[model samples]
Target: MNKTILLTGVVFGLLAVVFGAFGAHGLEKMVEPEAISTFEIGVRYQMYHALFLLFIGLWTGLKANKKRIVYTLIVLGIALFSFSIYGLALNSIIKFDFRSIAFLTPIGGVFLIFGWFFTGYFILTQKRIN
Candidate 1:
């Protein structure tokens, strides 16, 4: 599970960088400033969650089950939140209407919030810190 979390973190982090670069260069001329800004937000959140997963992978404070919960929530959050934003940002150029699924962004955000909350709750409730 730890290995899975670590690998996921690395993958997400790598993609964040790739996406960030694309947003800065390739997307600058293709999209409006507001779209670029929105895309950047997605990249930022993806990177943040990637680091969160990396830390969760290395930290021994949380049990396997707790780690799994966080992992699931975060993965889902990233998929729905960041990916949806990407689509929405590109909607102007793309044939598909990303606004159709715009509701997913906030739903994903809720999952991310829950993941963070659970992490803190689990750690706080633990009998030992170390």
Candidate 2:
């Protein structure tokens, strides 16, 4: 589970850097400043969650079942939150409608919030090794 989460985190981090650079360079010319800013936000959040997942992966004492749930939430959060923003940001260029799925961003945010909260709760409740 830990290694799986770690790999997921690495993938996300790599994509974040790629998207961030694309936003800073390629996107600026193709999209409006507002769109680029929005894309950048997606990149920022992706990077944040990526790091968070990485940390959680390394943190000790989590049982397998609990780890699965936490990792799932983080993964879904990235897929919904970050990817939705990426689509929204690129909508201008791609000319696709994202309004129907706009609600997903906040829902994804909620998942991420819950993920962190659960992680904290897990840490607090865990028996400390002497």
Candidate 3:
């Protein structure tokens, strides 16, 4: 699970960079200003959580097996939040429809919040090095 999370984190991080570049260069002229802003928001969140996943991966390497599920939730939350924004931005850009999924983004945010909460709980519960 750790390896899977780490590998997925790496992939997501790389893809976020690609999408950011695509937004900057490929989408600059093709998308409206508002859509571009929306896409940038997606990219920002994606990059943030991708780094979170990377940190989870590092923690997994040093922690107990119980931590893997929390990391996976973090990754899943990132995917849901980032992809929904990307899809919505694209839909707006192309004049397609996808309002139904917008509500899911908050749910993803909830997952992300809980993932971090669990991480903090684990850290606090661990035996102190002192």
User: Which structure among the candidates has the greatest lDDT?
Assistant: 1
Off by over 4 Å in 3: 60-64, 93-96, 128-130
> In candidate 2, which residue ranges exceed 4 Å CA deviation?
none
Tell me the tens digit of each residue's lDDT in model 3 across 1-130.
6677678788888999999999888887776878888888878878887887777776633464646768767777877887887888788555667577888778788888888888778778877522
Please tell me which model should have the higher lDDT, number 1 or number 2. 1
Tens digit of per-residue lDDT, candidate 2, span 56-105:
78877788777888899989998999999999988877767886798999
Worst 10 residues of 2 by lDDT: 121-130
True-vs-predicted CA distance for residue 55, candidate 2, Å: 1.0
TM-score of each: 0.98, 0.94, 0.86
In terms of lDDT, the poorest run of 10 residues in model 1 is 121-130
- Clashes counted in candidate 3 amount to 0
lDDT of 3: 0.78
Between the candidate structures 1 and 3, which one is better when assessed by lDDT? 1
- Residue-by-residue lDDT tens digits, candidate 1, 1-130: 9999999999999999999999999998899999999999999999999999999999998899999999999999999999999999999999999999999999999999999999999988999976
Model 2, backbone clash pairs (residues 3+ apart or across chains), number: 0
Candidate 2: TM-score?
0.94
Q: What's the residue-level lDDT of 26 in candidate 3?
A: 88
